[model samples]
Target chain A: MTMFTVLEGVAAPLLRENVDTDTVIRIERLVSLEKVDLGHWAFETLRYRKDGSDNPDFVLNQPRYRGARILLAGRNFGCGSSREGAVHAILGMGIRCVIAPSFGDIFFSNCFQNGVLPIVLPQAEIDKLAEEARESAAGGAFAVDLEAQEIRTPGQRTVSFATDPNRRRALLQGLDPIATTLQRDGDIESFQQRDRQARPWIYG
Target chain B: MPGQSLFDKIWDAHVIADLGSGTSLLHIDRHIMHDLGGGRGLRRLSELGHKLRNPELIFATPDHAISTEPGRTSETTPLSSGYMKVLREETKKHGVRLFELGEDGQGIVHVVGPEMGISLPGVTLVCGDSHTCTHGAVGAMAWGIGSSELVHVLATQTMVQAKPKRMRVSFSGRMHDWVRSKDLILYLIGRLGAAAGSGSAVEYAGPAIRALSMEARLSLCNLSIEMGARFGMIAPDDTTFEYLAGRPFAPEGRMWDRAVSHWRTLPSDPDAVFDREESIEVDAIAPQITWGTSPQDVIAVDGIIPDPASAANPSRRHEMELAQRYMGIEPGRPIAGTPVDRVFIGSCTNSRIEDLRDAAAVARGRQVAKNVTAWVVPGSYIVKCQGEAEGLDAVFRAAGFEWREPGCSQCVAANGDVVPPGQRCVSTSNRNFAGRQGPGSRTHLASPAMAAAAAVAGAITDIRQLA
Candidate 1:
């Protein structure tokens, strides 16, 4: 587990709504790929044309957005599939944080597990950040301090956020959750013993 | 406490530790995995020097990455075979139970879990696939988890989870014969967009849900994940108990009685208050089909393509326009007569024997329309054998449909089984996301019967009208 403190980098705006995992990292690219920089295959259909050149129409393909470490995306980002490959692709692209109005429950959780911070902000705030990102693609950097629960815009504007305190602590300390669960092995043992006796059917 | 919703009851019971603010460490009763996603978790566990805490609670099978071709072996498909090889080797090394191809228990994780009675009431089940919600129909707290958590659960038979808000969707009216559970869910998603159930665990109740068989309830809960809900469930009832009675892994005799006694107490109390409540009138739900990329981009079989100008807002209008261009369907054209080039009638969502019977009923005496390729992959080897014994496979074969073996076939298109680029396919799988089946392929999600009807008609047609 990698500890997260703050990420300060260029924020690219991917404003399309309902950006499903299939679009995030198409299932085709995810099937037999090696453990490499999957960012090359992220958003395969949208980022590349049939001839294999960059689809100039895609936001990520724009030269100004290169090396972006923060993503300002639309609602329901990572909406389909329980694929962590989507996160692998997002991180592969060097994106360390994502700001969205909302996200699919599983995708949001996966981001945290993979050391990427998923920040839920109001749509108005995201729209504002998206605007700032486009304006500052060359010289501006968006900074997010997970410890302070705040996102710093390119214009040095501060916006606050909220997260479950323990998850936040875990992220800050880079603690594996299973290790955290292991600290309570006695309780888990008690649960297993009681659960088995109480409901023996599921055991079969 | 006495009036708690089933969601609350399950969540409260499973919490091993409350890591404040709504997060809790949940004791996982069952953790299932498959070929495509399970191998990485095993590698991570080995790397971390963590022996599986409870190998007995873990089940593995090769479904997502196995070929559904008859007589297919690992060598037949290299990409899928590689994943299956990893699954076979890892499960063997770990002493985890695995159902490989040609085995009786071999099937899609969801189908095999419930069919083997491993997914029972009052348990918390997690799987590496989103359609794992299908097992929630048997009154369990079941949902999908990603690869990262799969490793966590493998290392420690528990995972930390955040409590989601509770939602109850009541379908108060009686469904018509042609309106299967698939139609009801499509109608729900169509009426409410794909994100309607986001961040909530939905419980399906009311007369319509209760009237459904265990298979139908599974179909409904399966798509609940499609709408962005991590999980969905129906309270266990006599229907569930009866369905699990004689299954291979189900308990027998007095144990069955004790299981029933516990299951009957798992329903939500009458006075329970849901965080959110929704109602759907099912009497008027006709056979439905998707016209565009999203499952929510659907219409009744008789309806026409939606005009973007009629959209309520610019964002929605933009969505309509995108779906229109991608699907190559013009506005105002009736969806019924839209020609289809392919038909796929199998997926975790609708590949059970009952689902096969639905398609078989439609394809019994009809030949698949010329130039339209169609296939029928059973949900499991058990289902395939049963279908053959009951002549359901013959009905499909007689209709010019290729009767294939069991696995997650073209549903995910992992095994080189894909709809060609620019081809129109009516499929029974859940998601209609762009490029979900294949790049540049247009998929119109439908019920098994509806997909079968489309195969014969060479176009989308209401199943009721076909009869």
Candidate 2:
């Protein structure tokens, strides 16, 4: 995973509610394409026409929003499926941050694993940020400073955010979480020993 | 100490250690995986030089990407063949059991887990698919995990998770004649918005829930994820125990007695307090169906399509309008009598034997509409055999509905069986998302009986009317 700290770039406004994992990347694409190449197929149904041409109406396909690193979305974004490919697709598409009112529980967790910052903001704040992104589409760069725990819009507005301190530390240092958890093997082993004696049938 | 919820009891039992900030390292009692993520995660774990910590706790099957065609092999779906092959190889290499296709226990992971008695009361189960919550019906503390998390669970037999608040959704009153467990859940999601259950573990309780059969309970809990709840469960009762009794992986003799005693203590305490509570009256719930993209975009089969202008907010109105356009539905129009081109009667949600019996009852002595193509893909190979032994397959075949093999067919559209582009399908699947069945495919989620009615009528019809 790449270390996430200060990221500044254009933010695409995909403010539709319930933007599920299926929309982020279809299951067909996930099966056929490599993880790194998933960017091309991210939002394939919404981004491209049936004939494989870019759908001009999509926000991400617009010239100004191209290469966006931030995504301003609506409530419950990434709301369906536990497919981690959704985060891979978003990261592949160069989106390092997703700001929404809320998110699906599994998708929110998946984002941290892949170094994609899923920030939860009040809907009012998200609307403001989305408006600013739309108004200055040509050069509306949003800066997401994970270290500072704040987002700065092109309009010079700074909005603070909160994330789990442990998750924040992992993302900042790009540390593999499994390694950290494995260090507590002694604790895990002891617990298992007790549980096994208590419920032998559960232990296979 | 006050009282503990069912979730609280199960969660506390599984905590290996608390990592602060409400997160805990949870010992996974059961970890089920499917072809799509299982193979990739295993290969990744190997690349990282990690060995499986507890292969005995892990179960793998190739359901998501395997073909459901009759007499199919791993190569039946060329695109997914490599995934199936890799899953077979990885599971073999790691000593994890793989439920091979066409075998007795093979099915969708969620369906297979509970049927094989791997998902038990008071146990914590995790799978790489969102519908893993389906196993919670057996009174397990089950939820979905992502790819990286899969590798973590495989390497350590545990996972780091934040504790979710407890929520109790009690369904009171008897259901109407034509209504089913699918309708109860669909109605709940429609009444409460899609995100209502976010950040909580929901326990379905009350007389109506208790009255449901084990299969119906499974169908109801299957949609917990659709309502944004990662975990949904019911207290283990006679219905759950009877369902698990004599199953392949269940405990035997003295072990069974001990297991039952433990499960009896797994329900919420009498004085248990939840962070939130909700009550629903199910007597008036009709057969529910989605008319738009999201599962929450649903209405009664006899209800009219909602007008976007009446939406609660601007963004909501925009979403409704877009959904209407994509679904090719007109605002304020009655959803019933809307023509459908296909009917799919299978998925982890409703592919159990009871579900097939329900659909077969509707299809008996009837013919599928001329222009409609209907298929019944059983949940598991055992379910297929049972359905055949019960003569449900003959009813479906006589009614022009194709009887297919078991897999997650047409549900995710990765297995080559899909409703074509721009075609409308009345499906007994969990999701009705855009392009869920196929690109440009419009899905109306319904009960199996309702889907069968649609197949016969070639349109969305009230199941009550048919009855």
Candidate 3:
């Protein structure tokens, strides 16, 4: 859990919308995965062919954004399945954060849980950033400052975004949700005690 | 005080600690596990020196990576056997109840949960699989969680979650015989798009949902994940209680009476208002099928493949283009009679007994197409036994469809139950995502009967046109 402050790097343009968990990382990759290098298989079907050679046509396969640390995506990114492998693959590939018009609820929470920032902005702003990212692929990088709640384009334009203060704190402090849940162990114990008397059969 | 919707009441009851900012420590009544990522969580918990706080509250099964091939054991494949071993060893060491493959109660986690009454009214259930919402059919507030979240629940029997905004989707309809609950959900996804239900807790209400059998209700809630919502529910009523009565995990004696009394109060208050509302007035709905990669790219049985150029929204147009290219379908072509090479009549979405009966009806006395391969994989051993007792297995076998054991089968290609590359299939599974069935395997998501019809026709054919 590395503290996420300012992440500056090439932003891969996954312009397509509804980049589902299936597309983000195949179930096959997760099933046989060990040590979690699933990032290489992100969009495996689209990124590679049967011969195991890179497809070269996919945005991630192109050399310019090959190791991008950020992603500029379409609306409704990560829409299906609550597979955390989607976020794992993204961060595993060194993509520190994702900027989309919106994201699937579970995937959004997963990104925060894993300390990979998922920023939601309006389509107009996202479109601008995607364009800026493409133009800067040769040299400059797209920069995100969580503390400032802004994304600075390579062209020097700062686009502000909003994130929950609590999520922001977790990202800044690199705290996972499990760690957060453990903080209320006493309350959880109290609820269990009260519930046991109230509804005994719900327990095994 | 504001009147609460049925979802709000159920959600509020589960809150152990109000974490503020819309988040809370919610108690989990049940934690169902499947083989895909099942024991991985327990392994992590053990490594951290944390034992399962409540093993009795958790249940495990090997469905995702198990073989549905007839006479199959864990040794059907290296992948399936390895996954089965992982859960068997962990659940044994941790004392969690497991329905191992080839065992009596073994089945898909979603199916086994409801059939055994482990998922009941006024409960909070979580599973590592996305389709866990299928349990919400019994009026539970259920959703899918990731492995990390699964570990958290294993240690605490609770999860930290943000309360989702409540939405009521009222469906009132006069359904034609060919129209099933599957069509209703596919139609909704087509109209709403995949992202429409993304963050909402959707409650299906009104006449249409009320008329659905418990299995049909489960079928409807099962695809809530496909439309982008993790949570979907139906208010528990007489239908729910009746379905659960006397089942293995349901309450008995005086405790059953008390539970029923509490469940009756779970329905939304008469004055309750949801944060949002959606209504569908369906005089008649044709059997629906997806023609493209996304579940939302659906059309009526008689409709044509959509043209991306005709889309009004640019984003939708882009999506349409990609889907069409990936699915290998041409725009404006008729969807009906589109040739298929395989027919899959099973999955959490439509593998229940009620679903099997419909497919068997279509298959009665009809031979599968000469060039097509078809399979009927039941949802669970219980469902398989029940279907066999009713002789539904004969109906499928006589019609030339393979009668297989219950597991995920081709619904997910995890254990190698896959449609080959460049092949097309008519399946009852939830998703039709590219490479979902297998790389270059194009899938058309349909109802069981529709799949049966397709199996016989060797093409996508309407169930109404059969017999």
Candidate 4:
């Protein structure tokens, strides 16, 4: 069974909106499928040099915000194309949860299937998280309790937000829509059998 | 649920049975298979020792990865050939209707369905491609399925699904000149932030929607997936009837009368409720072009690229920075006049005959910019033949754009036809994600005419200026 639980950890901030799948993993950094390295790809063009060294100018390389897990992002996160590879690259990079104001529709569903908790917070709460992440950029550690819906900053200030009940359950259970449907497989089978009798042409 | 709504009627009729815990075994009335993801389903069926259960309910076509390179026959594109072979093999084995390359009905599955009156209203349509929503323009309840589910559909003509909530996008006023359904949908996607359609199947209604031609309606629903909506639709009307009147698969003579009567009853009642609602004024919107990586990261032709620092939300700021750096554009730089190395005007998105005519109208007697390489591929072999017959190809060629063979070129870049790394391309196809065109390449989404105008101007220029 896939691991499904709330990711409670220091939120690492990669605050961006409309991040396309390609930037999450560049075509160059990828050799054949076997040489697939996840960390090297997450924001590869943004964080690394042509020679593959850490760009001191990159946000992740900053001393204060090291080892952050929760990616706090803007509205419509993971927008543009419907590349599943982007989801794979992010999940592989140890990003357990993403707190965004919004997510690209396909990407959000993909995250659920692949075991990424995408918490959609109100813009106001996301603003607070962004501010705290920015302010703690020097010290770099912030706490987010996914179960508590609270963000704990360096100075111990906590912020709370709301998430939808159904989504919360699905994320916590790691139950994708397909898996959820599979839970009622017997019922589905009975239904299909009845349907097949009615439309025998469809059942051959 | 009787007499509730067209949405409710279709939903309940198609739902074979309500499985416990909110799942349902859905009876698919129409199944469209394209080349991209459907081949994997064939492989799965092969491995499982399964033969298709209902081939008549299934229809297959070659689309994605089909090459548009002129003089390069189907033999050159191996991926497309492989996909086509599998599709052909399965269709023959199962007696499913196949729209092969030489078939008169061949085209983008979405385009072919409507033109042939195969995408009927009140049907549940399933396809392996996301843009199956395009079929929903005729009021069908359509959604894209994954490859595994596609196999299930192939084997049973039914797949298990959970119902999605419904949304209504209302547009009340008559659209202005030069702003077609393509622009309206693009503007809505830009305004609603692309993901607004998430968790919902959108029913597009209102005066503006009722005013669109069947082709225009198809264009609107085509990009529904681009905005996170599983499907987008408009209710059937006289326009739908008029378009389907003489099509090959449409109801004939006496059956036509009954079909029109049924199609007339396809719209939702006044009291039908939607889980969400979005309203947009058609007049206020302008031609859109994607600037950043995401389709939502768009600005009007007259607008500037958004600055990360100007963003109030921190996550937005970070995304802006990443988009800016990758796109190689400065903050606050106007999208118009941004240098474009290439301009592509094709794909399932805008490769229809009407779209080509629109672009050709703009390119007539005009020359492409010295620096820009432009391609104008049709959506099908039929379109290509018709274009050549009508001398539209000559118009494009005269304008210095290569009039290509039909395929899904430069849209997903699934084939080898891609822009070189780091170059910026103004494409008429949907999705402008970074590296979408190629590794390190940038894509700018626009209307077909806008792509033509940009090809001429060598940058992102408003088609209105040329008009």
Model 4: lDDT of residue B45: 73
Residue B367 displacement (Å), model 1? 0.7
In candidate 3, what are the lDDT values of residues A1-204, reduced to their tens digit?
557999988887787878888888988888883555887888787788779999888888888888889888887898877789999888888988898887887888778768789988888887887788778746357789999999888999998988887778887888766667777878888898899998888985
Across A1-204, the per-residue lDDT of candidate 4 in tens digits comes to: 144454544565665555655667653333232457777578887777878798987666776555556788766677544445566777776676788877766566556556677778777777777677777635445665556766666667776766555555655665545445445556656766675554332333
Per-candidate local distance difference test: 0.88, 0.92, 0.87, 0.74
Enumerate residue pairs that collide in model 3: none
Candidate 2 docking: what grade?
A: medium
Instruction: For candidate 1, write residues B1-467 as lDDT tens digits.
Output: 54988888888888887878888889898888988888768977999888888998888888887888888887778887688778878888989999878888788888889988888888899998888889989999998999889988998788888888899999988888778999999999888778877898999999888899999999999998778788899999989988988987778899988878877888999999898898999988989999888888989998889899999978878888998899989999899988999999998889999999999999999999999999998888888889999999889998999999888888898887888888899999998888777888899999999999999999999888889
Residue ranges of candidate 1 with Cα displaced over 4 Å: A137-139
| Candidate 1 per-residue C-alpha lDDT over A1-204 given as tens digits, one digit per residue, 9 for 90 to 100 | 778999888888887788898888877678874665588998888888999999998887888888889998888888878899999998998998988988988899899888999989888998898888888748378889999999888887999999778778989999987787788999988888898898776666
Ranking by lDDT: 2, 1, 3, 4
Give residue A60's lDDT in candidate 2 (0 to 100): 95
Ranking by DockQ: 2, 1, 3, 4
10 residues in a row with least lDDT, candidate 1 chain A? A28-37
TM-score of 1: 0.98
- The most accurate candidate by lDDT is 2
lDDT of 4 by residue, B1-467 (tens): 43455676678766765654555677787888776656556666767666666566677777665666777554566666766777677667667787776666676777777776777877788886677788888878887654556776776667665567888899878666566787888888888876788767888988888888777788888888878787688888888878878877766777677667766777888888888888988878778888887777777788988778887666567767878888889987788989989999887678888888989999999999998899998887777878888899999999999998777777767766889988989887777776777767898888888889899989899888878
